[model samples]
Target: MNTIEKQKLSVLIITLNEELYIKSLLKDLDFADEIIVIDSYSNDKTTAIVESFKNVKLIQNTFEDFTTQRNFALEKASNNWILFIDADEKLSPELKSEIINTINNPNPASAYLVYRTFMFKNTKLRFSGWQTDKIFRLFDKLKCKYTTEKLVHEKLEIKGEIAVLKNKLIHYSYTNFDDYKAKMKRYGMLKAREKFKKGHQPSFIMMLLHPIYTFLYQFIIRLGFLDHTNGIIICYLNAYSVFIRYKELKKITSSRI
Candidate 1:
C-alpha cells in the first residue's frame, strides 16, 4: 500500500545515550508519517543524529520510569496509530510492509504484537528464549497505554482486541559480551529497585533457587543449547542477572531494616 492510502502512523521512541544505534533506526523509520523521539538528555551524539531527521521531532525529557517516558511520547503523537520501537531495534522490511498493510486495513484490534529476533555479537540467535521474545509495540494510542506496574519490564495495557504480526523486529541489543554484561547489570539494579519499591523482601532460598531455575528453564527447557555457544552464554548471563537482582534486593532490604 502507498503512503496516501495507509493510515498515518507516529513512530515513538525513548532513548538514553543511544548514539550508536539511533541513526540506523531513524533511517529505517522513514516510512512513518511522523517520528517522535523522547530522549533522556543523552550526553552523546544521540540528540544530534535525531535532529538530522526531518520527519523526526526531538523532545528532551528528564530520565524517569520507562512507562512515564513512553506515555509522554504517546501524548506527543499526532496520529492515533502509534508504533513504539526501541532505539536498539529496527523494523525489518517484511515487518515494515506488514505494519503498513495492517494500518491500512484497520482491524478491530487495538494493538499488535511483534516478535523480535535478537542479534548478539553479529550472531542472530534463533533459540534460547529469544525466539519467544514478542512484545506489543504497535497500538492505537486511544486504546492502549503502558502499564506502570514494573520499572524495568513494563508492559502495554490494551483496552481492546489485539493481533500478532508474523514478521520479526530486528534487535541489535549487544555488540559483545562486555556490552551485554553491562546492560544486564543495569537492568538487574533497576529490577532490584523496583522490587524494593513494591515492599518485596528477598529470601536466601529465592536468591539461590531463582538463578538455578532461570538457567535450567532457559538452557534446557527452552532449548538454549540449540544456539550453541551464544545460547549458553545468554542463558548463563540471564541467570547471573537474576542472581544479581536478588542479591541487590536483599542488600537494599537489609539496609532498610
Candidate 2:
C-alpha cells in the first residue's frame, strides 16, 4: 500500500471473458492498495492474463445474479474506500489523478459519483441517453455496499453526501450495432423480470406511447440530434429495448399465471 494522508484504498472489478480491457485498467491503477477481480469463471485467457499481473487478486465464482456478484466482490475488498471499475471500462488519466487526490483529501461524504463517457466504435458518443449517465463508483466500504436485490443495474445505498468528479470513466459499452442489440436483449429481459416482480404494470396505452415518448425525449429533448446519425440510432435502439422489456415481462407473467 502506498503511504498517503488518507485511509487505504481498494479497487474492485467484475468480469467474465474480459481479457481484452482488464490489463490496461490494472496497469493504470497500479497505485491501488488492493485490486480484486471477481471473475465469473471466464474460459478465455482472462484468468491467465490477470494472473500475469502481480498486483491483481483474482477470485473465481460461478455465474450468479449481478447483485449477488457485485456484493460478493464488495466482500473481497480489503480497504476502507473502494473504487469499482467494470472489466470493459478504463479509468481515464484525469480520472485516475482525481481519484488519488480525492482519497488523499478524504471528504466526509460516503461516496463519489463519477461521470462515464461511452465510446462506440472509434467514435466517442456525446449524445443520446448516455451523455449524463453518472454512477456512484467510489465509496467508503464501511459506509456502503451494493443493493442485494436488483440484478442488472444495481446501485449502492449510502447515507452520507456524494461528491462529483469532473473526469470520466471511459466505457466501451458498444463495439458495434450487433453488440448493442445483443446486450439490449439480455438487459431488457432482466429489467422486465425485475419490473414484473415489483408489480409494475404497463398498460397498452403506455406500451404504445412510452416508447415513442422515450425516443423523442432522448433524440430531441435530450439533444441526441447533436450526435448526428449515431444519435438517431441510439434513440431508436433504446426505445426498442423498452418495448422488448415490456414484451418479455408479459411473457413471464403469462407463463406464471
Candidate 3:
C-alpha cells in the first residue's frame, strides 16, 4: 500500500557531520513525500551524498540551537505533517510498517512517540536508560515547536494528546566508549549552562544523591545489568554526566551568589 497517496507528510532531519549515517537512513525512508535535510555546514561529504538522492531537498543552515535548526527546517518543508528523525537513527522494518499503517489511517492523536533501540558498540544495550527511551517524532507541523531556551534534550511543544508507535527507531549512538564519553561531556556542559541561566540551585543532597539514584535506577532496577559490562558502563557514564552537570551548576551558582 502506498501510504503517501493517503496522507501527505514530510521527513525532516537536522544534521551536522553525519556523512556515515545519512545514506542508510534515507534509503529506508523513500515513503516520505518530501525529505528536508538542514545541514550545518558539514565539511564532510554530507551535502554531496544528500545531493545524490533524487527527492532530498538540502539546505545549508548554521547550527545555532536545536530549536532554531528544527524550526527552520519545518519552515522549509511544504508538508502539513512532519516526521522528525535524527541522522544517527533509522526506521526499523517494524517501524516502517507502523509508519505506513499510521499514514494510511491518521490516528486521533496529534503527536506520536516512538521508542528508540540504542546500540553501544557491538551490543544492543536494552537494560540501560536508553531501552525505554521514547521520543515524540511525528506531529502536525503547525502544532509543535522545539523549546528555544533548552537546547539539549529539546522536545516538541504539542497541545493535544500523544500516541505511541509500537516499533522502534534504530539508534546507533556510540561507536566506542570514548565516543559516548565525549558526547556526555558536551551534553553535560550544555545542561549545566541551562541550569545556571535558570537560576536553579542544586543542594548538596541533590548533587550527591542524584547520580547515585540515577545509576541505581538505570543499572539495577531498570535491568541495565542484563546487558552486562556495556550496560554498566553506559549507566555509569550517564550518571557521571549527571554528577558533572550538577557539580558545574553548583559552582556556577555559587560564584553568582
Candidate 4:
C-alpha cells in the first residue's frame, strides 16, 4: 500500500554513520506517513543519503546518549503516534500491515513491542539469546518517553498499556567483525559512565566474573552453541562488552582518588 492510504504515523530513527543501510531502509518506509531521521552528526554519507529522500526530514544533532536522542525525536514529531526504528532494522510486509491495523484499532494499545530476527552480518542466527530480542518501537509519543538511565540501552516509560505484535522486524545485521567490536567497546564505555552516575562501583571480582557469567549464560543457558560459529562469536563479544564495562568503571572511579 502507498503512504497516503496508511494512517498518520511518524516513523523515527536515530542514526550515526549508517550510510551503508540508510538508502535501502528509507526506501522500505514508503508506507509511513512521515519519516524523520535524527542523525548524530555523522562524518559519513548518512546525511546526504537521507536528503535524497525529499519526504523524509533529516535533522542532525551532536552525539549524545541514546535516551537523549530518542526523546529529542519525540519532541520533533508532528504526529501523536510514532514508530521508533533503528537504521539497521527493516519491517516485513506482514509486520507493516500489523502496525497499520493496530493503530487504526478502535481501542488499540498505547505502546507495542516488536520482535526481531537479528542477523549477524548477513547470517541469521536462530539461537544465541537473539531469538527473543524485542523492542518497543511503536508508541503514542504523548504517553511515552525514554527513561533517563541511558548510555547502553534506552527504555521507554509508558503511561498506558502495551501490546506485542506477531510479525517480526528484520535486524539488517552489523557492519563487520572489527566494526562490531568497536561498537561493543563504545557501548561498554557508555555503560560504565552510566553506572558511575548511579553511584555504582565495580569490584575486581565482579569485573573478572561478569564476563565469564555472560559468556556462560548466553552460550550455554541461552543456547548460543546451537547457532554454531557465529553464535559463539556473538556470545564472546557480549562477554567482552561486560568486562569492558567493568574495566571502564574501575578506571573512572580510580581517577577520582
Best by lDDT: 4
Q: Estimate the overall C-alpha local distance difference test score of candidate 3.
A: 0.83
For residues 1-257, could you state the per-residue lDDT of candidate 4 as single tens digits?
Answer: 64433358999999999998989999999889889999998999999999999999999888778888888898899998899988899889999888889988878788999999988888888998998999899998888888888765788888989999999999966668887888888899989999999999879999999899999999999999999988888999989999899999999999987
Q: 126 in model 4: Cα distance from truth in Å?
A: 0.7
Residue ranges of candidate 2 with Cα displaced over 4 Å: 1-6, 202-204
Question: TM per model?
Answer: 0.92, 0.90, 0.86, 0.95
Each prediction's whole-model lDDT (CA): 0.88, 0.83, 0.83, 0.89
* Candidate 4 whole-model C-alpha lDDT, 0 to 1: 0.89
Better of 2 and 3 by TM-score: 2
Q: What tens-digit string does per-residue lDDT give for candidate 1 at 1-257?
A: 64555589999999988988999899988689999999999999999999988778999999667777888898899999999999999888888988888887845479998888899867899888988899888888889888877777778888988899989898999787887888887788878988998888998999999999999999988999998888889999898899989999989988888
Output the better candidate (3/4) by TM-score. Answer: 4
Lowest summed lDDT across 10 adjacent residues in model 2 is found at: 100-109
**Model 3 weakest 10-residue run by lDDT:** 100-109
Candidate 3: residue 248 Cα off by (Å): 4.2
Q: What is candidate 1's CA lDDT for residue 106?
A: 40
Model 3 stretches with alpha carbons more than 4 Å out? 1-5, 202-208, 247-257
Which candidate order results from sorting by TM-score in descending order? 4, 1, 2, 3
Query: Model 2, range 109-202, lDDT digits (tens) per residue?
Result: 7899989998876689898878899998988878887775576888788877788988998898877787788778777788787888788775
Residue 65, model 2, lDDT:
66
Provide the lDDT at 124 for model 3. Answer: 78
Query: What tens digits encode model 3's per-residue C-alpha lDDT throughout 1-36?
Result: 645457778999988778888999988787788998
